[model samples]
Target chain A: MGKRFTLYTTIFLLIGIGLAPVLYMFIRSLFVDGGFSLRNYETLFQSDREWRLLFNSLSLAGATTLITVLLGVPLGTLFAKTDLPLKRFFTILFVIPLLVPSYILAIAWFYCLGRSGIVAMIFNADVGILTSNLLFGFAGTLFVMVSALLPVVIILTITYLRMVNPNLEEAAMLYGPWTTVLRKITIPLITPGIALAGLIVFILTLGEFGVPSFLRFDVYPVESFTQFSAFYNFNTATAAAIPLGLITLVVLIIERFFLRKKTFIFRTMGSEKKMLVVPLGKSKPFFMVAVSILVFILVIIPLCILIHKSVSISAYTEAFIRSIGSIMRSLVYASIGATCLVVFGFFLGYILARKAIRLFYAVDSIAIFLFALPGAVIGIGLSGLWNTPGTNFIYASMCIIIFGYIAQYTALGERIMAATFSHVPHSMEEAAQNVGAGWFRRLSGILIPLAKRGMVATWFIGFIFCLRDIGITMMVYPPAHDTLPVRIFTLMANSPEDVISAMCVIMIMITLLPLGGLGLVKRYIK
Target chain B: MVAKMIVKIDNVSKSYNKHSVIKAISLDIEKGERVVILGPSGCGKTTLLRIVAGFIHPNQGKVIIDGNVVADNGKCIIEPENRQVGMVFQDLALWPHMSNYKNLEFGLKAKKIPKMETRKRIDEIFEKVQMTQFKNVYPGELSGGQQQRIALARALVMQPKILLMDEPLSSLDADLSLTLRKEILRLQEELAITLIYVTHDREEAFSLASRIVVMESGKIQKTGTVSEITAYLSGL
Candidate 1:
């Protein structure tokens, strides 16, 4: 009916679904034996062990950002600015790790480097043991995290490079060589973008529990998850998470106050045909060989290992037979979660893009803060808030997991849809209003139709995030109701390597299906 | 007492995907003269200017600047930097991250101009453009007309053998464009460098050009003195 009423109601529902549980958990943590206390957060940085873990978390995140930036900048430059052959193909090849979960990549690495793995089969047992030792510690964890988060930097770099006005480079060229122009103009211009990428990588790597836990790296998120899952100690778990929450808060503050405005320009920033394509010339062969070696090492070998290990029909069949129910539930729940996220994201993004209300900033901040918070933290918070008998329908059923997905992934949809909605002219809505059309009429007739492709893309992303999600889902999943990623995780320890590989392969393929479908849908929607 | 040619484009042609942008266009720019290539958007005037500036390699042509074969037969014989030219792009294309002073100093440092010389040139150029107060200000913080002046100063500070301007004042308001046009005219008079400016506006060409080359569909239809070009347009 009324626009404000509808908008406020929807936002209220979002707060209820997403923000309320976390707040409820925080409040519950403050009370011990019916007396208010800081008992949960009292030991936030108390001991040497806590300091070590904090160092571990910060160093992992910092190293991941460093390595990914070092690698991604060059690769992103090659793709965005150069006439490198098969640039598109190389881009997709590099992006493969982004589509697959980082933990899955870790698992694949383990199979290839373990004591009885490919290294042993190819070389010798001692070499295999050496590699396995390297693979199971900080080195292994850093490698997996770098590969996983590398795409963020590369994508961001390419996006930022496109925003560099080609004319600027040409003007610089009048004074010096391509190298000079790049140094003097292009790199300096995109420095803000690079910093944003670094911030994102650090935050992501900080909150990451999956890869670190798989590689046996002692980190904050893993510590939080262990405190909850191993000890069943909610106070320590929440306490462990508080440090991460504070870090995320600091990061969010930086992003909102300093970076968000700069980042928004990227939505409008893109390269056109007029932007110069750098000719690689004689150096082309050298770059090609280098890129090929990296591709072979990073992408090809692990993929071949997976295919080689799990090529049997029996493995696929067993994978299917054992996890078919989990796969089906993951699909249904992700679909429902994605649908809910899209609906909520649409309204939130509208408020943001149009600045419909002053509280849009607060809503956006909370959404991003939740998204940036470790999934384990959200999972623990959800369980603490809803595990009572009165809320057993939510706690015991799959609804709590869905709630986790919505809370954790809504920002993905919101930010993307906000970018999409910013492209739509406000005049169209005003014109519809001038014609005496109501809000719903204007929305259905103008906004939705214009924004259909972005909505689909948003839903697809939401679906992918919800599907691959383990941190949130693992903590809250009821008995016998695990999703595919959760099932893959549970099976990793006890199942046959071949079956586990097959399950991972199936999960990857399932993730890719929507990608292909989205491509087709986008191609035709215009 | 004939004019000395400082730049020559011989049978230059460029096409992208078989859609010809510049079709075997040839032009000569004389030393210390203002030549305006006037046409509507997409008439390849800017592309031709870019070719002379050594940014784009022609498919079948040779570009000679001051008796040096800068580009020939789809190959860049001398790179853009070595061409001894400067350009003020249509969008100004000022390096946004750098201060206005650094923007002016960049080309000098690239050429390994001595540090004191770079500073002196920057000061002289900024002072000439009356932008000394904004030496520390970035391009993004400047107004449209101020940035235009800075762009002009950036190009002119190099004291190039040739200067290319591609509709640098088109984005500014009418009053600002008028003022900047006069400023450009005064600078050309004072500096006496060869100028090849591109603009779709005939009035801009008339005011800024000693000679006008009228182009259509990448082909130059008329090239003469400004009065002759005006008469040619009247006949058309």
Candidate 2:
């Protein structure tokens, strides 16, 4: 009875806070000012500009998904299933682009390929056609987005590959070479996982606001933001968001269908053997070079360019001094928000893990829907819901920003926690219960201790996401409540190149520091 | 003289999504008796054991342990902790995060045993299992036989009136299985507890059972002594 109460409370609270804004937006789009009407949506369909924005969003997402799958699947398989040299180091480097905010990556590319960039400076050449034409349009947006999102495919694919039963692979190897074995045995087994990863990347890219916004590529999120912020047309902005939200919802449903039957099976069983690693043989060096070059292009070059541009510590100091308030606010708000997410996520995860409630799939779908809603849409919805005439206390405080963070990133926390919880056998807790440990004792002594690593991981991921958020913060932040991402984004149009670069480098450092600390702790413990 | 009844499973039936797994099964167990539930895989032997241990609730009837109504017809359940039952799972289910000693100590501490009494009880069980030297080691660091011993020690330390084991030696090699089976028999005899064990292994069932309940398709086909079971098997 107590457990049921907790589960219902968590589900209701998550729906109330995390999902209500989007629900409000959807309902609001159906009405104009006071009465029920579809004028906003009608106007949305009537405008060619809106249609073009929608096309740009879909095309970018589709192209990014295709490119990511091409690069990520084979590389992920190689790293996970073959004897790739320095696999750990390369995997870490490949994932660096994912950790850096998308806008930061876009800015790095801009600095590297812009007219007065390093290449132009070194060659004393007019690369305006390449920089101005190529780097500021669809091509630059696709490139930046792919680099940032490819890790989703690679990481998830590697996980699925690891989960493929080794016995199946070994049996296939008896009949054919490793390549044939992978095709017949491994790939088919993990196809659902790969497809799920692809769909996630598709939805993420579709809803992405940062890279497109930074590169001046007109997409739905950017259009939605312009409608709300520039034109003060909340109704049109809400309507614009509906198409993107619906697309994301459709993709999320597809992902859910793929995940329903297979999610628990991918969990590592104690009896299952480790993944088989075939020797790379003579192609080892070629594989190593390929991975190294990819990492250099994706991770090392952008970072080096940022470092080169921010050579003066004085520039960093100036940026830091100017944005100290935003930086501090970012840390405080993100920490509070992440802590809340971890708490709520733990209960939500427990419900899913134990199937403690009926309609769990509905709860899961809601989480995914909220997560997949474009940040700009969520931003508009939050303001619409909270920015009331008399609710200034919440609207004018940091509460709104923190609420946005929780609504956006609790899904991430839930995902991490649910995965962790799946590995824990119900029998372990039952064993504890049979030995006369009550619920709290069993939980504290067994489940929490067992799941501590996962909890820590969820917290860190939530923290990083909150720290790097921009769109929702931009829309909801009170005066004097700017976060680091919003501050840097605002300054990019007018700040000196050195200061902008310095701030980007600082953001990278801030993100990397926690990751580095976690790595060190893991090594020491191991 | 007939032994006193310690457990009575009265017309217990269980189902998953309305596909019945345990079909109105009833059994009476006496104190100090070793009752082995022998069945093929998927015959609901483990489910029966769990229902008695209060890990599961039956759909049609009641489980009475020590004259107390523990569970009834899917409506009321005495939680596993309050049942004072000790179970050794097939996979051992030893908490991987703790040392072997801590695993044993957890239950004793949960029963609110004092620090000194808990330490003494844990030490005694560790000594009985000949695992005293490795008490501080985590289960992952232990050999299979040693880990099996730790699982036994963890259950014995609980000092419950009944001990339920579900194919606990199934994962071990033949030699290790023989050794652990002997250890289990010794523990059962020494503890003088009511034992309800589930196993599919014929030799294990024959060796450990004071009475063997043979089940097929969630129905008991026979309940008899070893010789009677042997006779029944030969007739089949």
Candidate 3:
């Protein structure tokens, strides 16, 4: 009875924590003169600017997705298939961008490309297409996000490609033409993977707040911000989120409809065989040089500039000192958020993996739905939800930002923990019980100790993710408050490139400590 | 006429959804009896053992132990923790996380045995299993034979009345399996515990059990002494 009651408690607590904001949004949307109405949504779509905003957001997301897949699929294939020199070195380069936030990349790119940008001075004339109108509005925002997120697309595609046996490509080599092999055999096998990458990128781009906002684009997030800032109209902002939610829902439905059954069997089967290295041959040098330059310009240069910006002497030493305090506060908030995410995520993972817990599938989907929603929407929903009468418990507190962190990153923790849990057999626990060990003892003394590496990883990843996030935290930040990423954003508007550069270096260094600690812990535990 | 019943099963059955796996069957294990359930692949021998271990509940009937109805169609009464049985899985299922010492101490603490007593019992089990030299080593660090030994010691530390093994030696090599089989037999004799062992190996069943239950398609084909079961197998 106690066990059953605990399960119910876990379930309700999760629903309350996760769904409260979305529910509040719904309630607030309906809160019209003590009655419910769809007027909030109606007001949102009624204006010309709102329609343009919707189109801009949709087009930007669509363009980002298309551009990312174009760059990512080829790069993923090249990374997976070729025996290019320094394969290990390149793999690290490919994944490092994912560790940096898109907004940071946006700031860095803007820093290097703005009128007083380093590139402008270095060239001593109008240099690249960026100096033209390409780096300003929709195209600029779309281009920056693509450059940042293409690595994510590459990583996801690589995971899929890794699952496909290189033997299949090798199998084709003996008979079909190379183009045919690529078009027919290789592409079909990795189609689902490509689709998955594209879908994830689309969803992420749709929800993206940082890059678009920095570009001064009038997208949904920006418009939502305007509505919130100008009119304090929670309803109109939530109405904006309704469209964002529909976009996410549509992606979810489309993915489910097409890929549901296929994913299960594909993942279970594992990769067919080790990659048969497709010799890059004559094209190797050109491809290597080209990719090397792209990576340097896109990732490294911007990061280097940010590090420079952060350390440069400025007029206001006190504001710089206060920035240190802001960094600390951000760290505390993110750490708390990460811990909460990992704990709830671990419990959710345990339940899903146990199979004995009914409603495992439903809970899994709900968790994922919240995860898939844009940070902007979650921020909007949460702000709208809490700003209402009688919800003062969390409205202006650090708890709101922390809640957003959990809602966004809990899926990552669950994924890591569940993968680890499934590897440890259920029979092991049964065996412990059969030997007279009670449930709690068996779990603490045995199961948890065994899964320590995964546990540490869950916390570490969650922490880093929270640390880098600006999208949701920006919306919920109280006046005069600043997280590292938020500070980085503020610097984008006012401070010199080197100051922002210094802050980025600081942020990355701080995040890497725990990541390194996780590695050490994994080794010790193992 | 016979010894006291350590465990009882009354017409217990189980299945997955529509497919009946273990049909209505009843059995009793007397105190200190060494019984082997032998079967071909796909038989319900494993399921029957799992039900007795309290990992799974029977679709019908009851499982009673020491005059208490632990499980019944009316309502299952006892949890696996309270059943006082020790199981060794086909995969060994050694707690890969813990050192050998911790694994042995787990069951003792769960029983709320005194700290000194738990430590003493662990040392004794380690010595008995010849694992004192490797007590600090985790399961991953140990050889298969060593891991199997740790599992047995961990189980035995609980001082269970019944020891259930479900093809515990199936994963080991021939030499390891044979050696471990001898160790199990010796341990059972020393402990004077009831044993309900499940396996599909003919020679293992022949060598281990005083009595053998041969099963097929979730029903017992025959049950008797090993010699009697061999005679039954040969005749079929």
Candidate of highest DockQ: 2
Maximum-TM-score candidate? 2
Error of 3 at B64 (Å): 1.5
Each prediction's interface RMSD? Answer: 22.1, 0.7, 1.3
Q: TM-score for every candidate vs. truth?
A: 0.68, 0.93, 0.92
Cα error of candidate 2 at position A72, Å: 2.0
Note the chain A TM-score of all models in turn.
0.96, 0.96, 0.90
Displacement of residue A467 (Cα, Å) in model 2 is 2.2
Point out the worst 10-residue segment of candidate 3 chain B by lDDT: B67-76
Give the worst 10-residue stretch by lDDT in candidate 3 chain A. A313-322
Write model 3 residue lDDT over A1-526, tens digit each, in one string: 5545555666676676667787777677776767878777777668888899889889988898998899888888788777778766666666665666777777777767776677777885467445734677887788788877887778877777777666667778889866678778776777788888888788888888888887788788777766766687778777887788888888888887897667765667566467556678888999899789877876778777776556545623533564787788778987898888777777778777786477887777777788888787788777766765687668777878888888788778877888889888888888777777766676677678867777877877788789888778888877656687887777657765556666666667777777667668769979
lDDT: which is higher, 2 or 3? 2
> Residue pairs in steric clash, candidate 2?
none
Question: Which of 1 and 2 is ahead in lDDT?
Answer: 2
Top candidate by lDDT = 2
**Relative to the unseen true structure, what is the C-alpha lDDT of residue B97 in candidate 3, on a scale of 0 to 100?**
65
Candidate 1 TM-score to native: 0.68
List chain B TM-scores, each candidate: 0.98, 0.97, 0.97
What is candidate 2's CAPRI-style docking category based on DockQ? medium
Across A1-526, the per-residue lDDT of candidate 2 in tens digits comes to 5557777888887887768888898898888768999898889999998889989999999999999998999889888988988897778888888876789988988888887777777665577446756889899999999899889989988988878878877888899998899888788788777887788788888878888988999999898888998998889899998999889877777666666567556544223688899888999999989888998998889889898888898999988998889888888888898888887778778777777677877887787788887788888888888888887798899988888887888788888888788889988888898888887787789988988888898888988888888778887888999988888999999998899999888888887888889889999999
On residues B1-236, what C-alpha lDDT tens digit does candidate 1 reach at each position? 99889999999999988999999988888999899999999999988998887667899888999999989989989766567787887777665546888777766765667999989989998988999999999988999999988988888888888888988888888898899999998888888888999999998999999999999998999999999999999998
Error of 3 at B86 (Å): 0.5
lDDT of each: 0.85, 0.86, 0.79
